[model samples]
Target: MLELTNVSSGYGETQVLYDLSVTAKAGRVLAVLGRNGAGKSTTLKTVMGLLPTRSGAISFDGATLPGKPYEVAKAGIGYVPETRDIFPSLTVRENLDLAAKRFEGSDWTIERVVELFPRLGERMSNGGTQLSGGEQQMLAIARALLMNPRLLILDEPTEGLAPVIVQQIHDKLMELKRGGLSMVLVEQNFGFATSLADDVAIVSKGQIVWTGSPAEIRADIEAQHRWLGV
Candidate 1:
């Protein structure tokens, strides 16, 4: 559903990506694994058009994506950053209402998202800041789903949450996968990322050092240590 060919990007004067090519197919999760400062988040930002690619192509569903975030979103890719970004003053319902992007034939509705995440339904009237951190993360995911995106790109979805909440997010992601939603997950929790991913890519120094299946990553201890420093 998404493809990047030799895409290179960076902040002003400091490069963070180098010929990074990756693909996340429809109905599958592609986990990008790396240690701190390994450019995993940079790759996602480039794909989301938060950072412009210096060279190469990014395409979604066979069409070239313009290097603008709104254009990217209009093409059906949803991004949730490491920060649980939401309108702090808005109620849960109001936040969801603001993210509506219904194209003809889209299937994910706000009601369906609330059904998937019942906690969100329960807190419909609560202000964003009033919810717990985990609840806010849930709200972020729910808000993204409300866009009815074809591919969901998440950056460090389980970075700083309690284990129980991580498990909750994991279970919800699995359900979304079963329902045939494509996802690109940039994750730090190795076990959680591998367990849910069909394909794995290890990034280091702004480049992909390894690409394989989850089982292969688990089996090759040497590659694990070399690229991931784990």
Candidate 2:
């Protein structure tokens, strides 16, 4: 479980998030939905300590989050930035090997990840730059899972991919959900996100404007238009 309460953060002298708050419950998906520049990605960055938490608090699993990115990752939080920051020069196996971490009772393994992403298995020797957009996204997710995170934070997992690839990503995420992974997702693909998310938080101008079930958000056309521009 993760909670960000009244958190406000931003770039130097240009605040983006304003008293923002959201929660990701245990073994459930929380989708943060917003238009561009709504500060959705900023929320995740602040939580990861990539950006300083200018004000307010972020707690994970009942403890205050560490103030450094690596420490946060060690604390059982995995982040997949929207950029899918993979090492372009490294082979697929090399990239995954660098992120591999194991602990007592850890269920994620390279074998399991490859099973989840068969494409990645076949492309084990391929360089990061040689992969397609969807393959890169799969690699990113696979790398994160290798860290054995208790809570996975993904930013825009379905962005810039073909519809069929999106569906593949969606199906893989569903499998992860069924395996009881707690996830916080920020995504532009509404239908893909809503299908997987247990709850929805709509961000507007760097703050959460609404929180509801996916079904509730789907039916509220006015909220969709007003807050999400859907």
Candidate 3:
């Protein structure tokens, strides 16, 4: 459903991604694994068109995404960033309402999101700042779900959350995957990655060094320690 070919991107004067090529197929989870500063997040940003690609191409659902954020989002890709990008001043209902504008099909809705994260239903009137980190994360995911995106890109969705919350998020992702949602997950938690991913792409020094099944990654202890610093 998504493809990146020989893509290179970075901040001004310092390239971070080195001809990185990756693909996330429909109805499969591609776990992108790397340590800090490994350019994993940069890859997602480039795919989302938030950062300019110095070279190469990104195509989603058979069309090349324009090098613009809105254009990419409009092309059926939803991004949930590391920061959880919720509007601090907006109520949960309002946040969800805003996302509803992007809905395309009957696959996703506020009711479905409320079922996924019941806490959001209880806090529908509360502003983003009033929600806890876990609550905010749920809100962010719920908002994305309301968009009914064909492909969901989650950047460290489990980062900094309690283990219970992480597990909850993991369960939701697995559920989505079973229901045929394509996802590219940028995850540091190997256990979580292994639980949901069909394949794993181990990245180092801004490029994909190893791409294989999750079990294959698990069996390769040397590659894990060398590239992931585990």
Candidate 4:
């Protein structure tokens, strides 16, 4: 459903991605795994048009993606950054309100997302800053769902959270996957990622070094040590 071919992008003269290529197929989850500074997040940013595609192409659902982030979102792609970029001053409901978009046949709604995330339902009136790390992460994902995206790109959904909270996030993502939501996940939690991903792409130095089924990646200890340092 989403393809980035030979894409290169960076911030002002310091190139981070080099001829990188990856694909997230329809109704499947693609996990991009890499160590820090390996340009994993850069790949997502380029695809989302947050960073200019310095070279190569990105296509979504058979069409070239627009050159703006908002356009990309409107094109049915949702991004939940690792930073959990919620408006600290806004109430939980207010944050979700900003991202709500409705169209014919849309499956996601504020009421539905709140159902998926019961914690969010209880904290609708709480300010963004008042939530815990896990709650903030839940709020971020809930807000993205409010957009009714066809493809969701999540950067480190489990980062900096307690193990129990990580499990909650993983369970919720599994529900989304079962619902046929195409996703591109960049995460450091290997077990959590591999459990949910159908395909895995290991990135090194800004380029994809290996692509395989999650089962293949899990059993290849040498590849894990060499590419992922696992």
TM-score of each: 0.96, 0.97, 0.97, 0.97
> What does candidate 3's lDDT look like per residue over 73-141, in tens digits?
778888999999999999999999898865646477888899989999999999999998999999998
Candidate 1 local lDDT, residue 210: 91
Stretches of candidate 4 exceeding 4 Å from the true structure:
101-105
RMSD per candidate (Å) reads 1.4, 1.3, 1.1, 1.2
lDDT (Cα) of model 3: 0.90
On the 0 to 100 scale, the lDDT of residue 171 in model 3 is 89
User: In order, what lDDT does every prediction score?
Assistant: 0.89, 0.94, 0.90, 0.92
Evaluate candidate 1 by giving its C-alpha RMSD to the native, one decimal. 1.4
* lDDT score at residue 41, model 3, on the 0-100 scale: 93
lDDT of 4 by residue, 1-230 (tens): 89899999999999999999888999999999988999999898888888999999999999999989889988999999999999999999998887774433467888889999999989999999999999999999988888889999999999999999999999999999999999999999999999999999999999999999999999999899998889
Residue-level lDDT of model 1, residues 1-230, one tens digit each, is 78888989999999999998888888899999998998999999998888989998998988898789888887888889899789999999989888864443357677888999999999999999899888998999988887788899999988788999999999999999998989999998999999999999999988888999999999999998888777
Point out the higher-scoring one by TM-score: 2 or 3. 2
The 10-residue segment of model 1 with minimum total lDDT is 100-109
The top-ranked prediction according to lDDT is: 2
Residue pairs in clash, model 3: none
lDDT of 4 at 85: 96
Model 1, residue 180: what's the lDDT?
A: 90
